[model samples]
Target: MKLHIVPARTGFQWVKLGAKTFFRQPLAMGGLFFMFMAAVSVLSLIPLLGTLISLALVPAATLGLMAASREAEQGRFPMPTLLVTAFRSGPANTRSILVLGAMYAAALMLVFGVGALLAPDVPAIEMPEGEVSPERVRAMFNNPGLWVALVLYVPVLMAFWHAPALVHWYGVSPFKSLFFSLMACWANKGAMLLYSLGWMAVIMMAGVVMNLLAVLLGGAALLNIVLYPMVLLLAAMFHTSIWFTVRDSFVTQEDRAA
Candidate 1:
């Protein structure tokens, strides 16, 4: 596959195309995403190692969703089995993806470690044996540790943004995928800037709408009932956007059609 230097406006089109793909097979797409979440949740049940494994599987999971999007874009229902495309594509592709996943998991753990180093031992949560008291929960948000994690995550995110797509679709090796992905992102800096700003605007609008709903409905508690599903839909759309990023940045339209 070849990299395409799309104009700045092309960035906005990813989310637009993503919305169109989502509407095309909402049920199938939603079901598959929820299944993915459930699978991750199940994996997370395995104790400390479970969380690591879940993070590692991220790239593979993302590619599976992209594969599903391809089917949805073609007017076909995305089957659950499509999730294994990365694993079964070819031996080299499978190995490369697995290596990428392992690298992701390692990078995440390193980020968490750095956060711990940057944060001071300020406070601890205490309450019932099973859960933190409500006050403690609020205190955690005010803790500096949270900001440390958030700050360190930005660059980690930038590095992996296109790595999975490169490995899965372009047959790049694990280390090379990271470099090429970063370079591709750097090359499309203007478009990515617009894309980021556009999403921020949408997020602001969503927050405004949610708050208005809470006010009209007389309680923030009940608003969550409506907001949760909306959040999930937005999350799905974001993944769809990632798929389109891969398409627009790597494949020509005519090639994508074939």
Candidate 2:
């Protein structure tokens, strides 16, 4: 089959495809959730191990892409079995995905460290006789150097924005994956920015809701359990959307035409 790269689709279409693919495979989706829980559990036990295991997060993120690709390859999108076959076929692709993921993590950590260093010292919050002042909190937000660091790090952020999908869909080398992912972001800057912003909005809303629920429920653990699966689900969908975009934008039909 020839690999024809398509133009980036609308966010709604990408998200719809992701939801459809996820809901179609219960066991596979369950397995993906299990892997995420296992990673979280392991990380909670050992911080260093968690950092190492973090490399797999992108591969976990790409599970939907793997499932979708396998279904397409087999000429059948069977509901219950899609994820199983996807996992079987994912070893090589997952390795590539992890390689890109590790590179991205390293880059992000370096950027974040630099940002932290450049940021001004945060003042200690002193409670008044009764309540903390909002003005005091707002005053801490005034750091130009930190802002500069953030601006400089945008390229690194953009590089990783679609990396998992690039690896999963294209099975490209790490260098090529990084190159194409960033280039795709550059080519479709507006769409990519909107995608990033939308993801942030979802995450922020989820956080707010979960915090509120925690206050009402009296145990944040329940909130964590609920949010964990949802986070994994959203991560899976986001990576799948990127996979579709990369498959459409980077992998050429001619290259696979042979």
Candidate 3:
């Protein structure tokens, strides 16, 4: 597939487009997002491997959301089953996303593995096995493991950023999709930089607004209680923005289909 070379300013437009798309189908999109999060949360509850499985499913879930966005664009409500479009499309599509998921899981595992290796003696909570205490959490932040994991996750993020869309939309293979996604990001790094900065600006503005509300209401607890929906809204928009970025990176739907 031929990648589109959009201007650096295009990133902002993608956010705008994402917002428009999300608003057009807010109920459907919101429900789908809730379902997605619920699924992830449930999967992450497993004893040891749950988190990895949840991470692996992320790409597939993301592709499903992209499909939902397309449906919303067509003025149709996205169905709950849209979450599994990647898996149900056909063997080829299923294989591509599954492989991508495996790679993502492996990469994340590698990141944590390296982190453990780097800080084998990192202390744990001195409590029940399944219960995490505040001291343990604080200690983890002061340890090397967190930083190592964060540093190692960058390449993994880059590799999987646009991979799901590439596979679902353009029928790209798993490994090639990773390469193309990386190249596409590198090529459009300037736009993405702007995009990231824009997100930070929005987040800052949200914080400002939250603080203002807290002060005006004379109770930070009140705003804290009410701000959850707003945060979820911003999160939905961010996920939608990811779809827009992927859409703009490739040829038009008709051309890509051909």
lDDT of 2 at 137: 56
* lDDT, residue 147, model 2: 77
> How many residue pairs in model 2 have overlapping backbones?
1
Rank the models by lDDT, top first: 3, 1, 2
Q: TM-score each candidate.
A: 0.86, 0.63, 0.85
Cα lDDT tens digits for candidate 2, 1-258:
122333344544555555566566544555654565575677757767576566545444455545554463344543444333324455786566567667766776676678778777776777856454886657656765667678868887666665555555456676776676677778876555555666777778878888898888866677767886677767765544554445445545666664
* Residue ranges of candidate 2 with Cα displaced over 4 Å: 1-9, 56-99, 123-153, 162-171, 197-233, 254-258
Write candidate 1's Cα lDDT for 1-258 as tens digits.
667788988778776888889899888788778777888999999998999889988998889889999899888989988787889887889889889999999999988887777666766655656454777766677768678888777667777888887887777788988887777788888888888887777778888988898898877676767787888887787776787777777765568688
Q: Report lDDT (Cα) of residue 245, candidate 1.
A: 78
| RMSD to native, candidate 1 | 3.4
Model 1, position 121: C-alpha lDDT score = 70
TM-score, model 1 to reference? 0.86
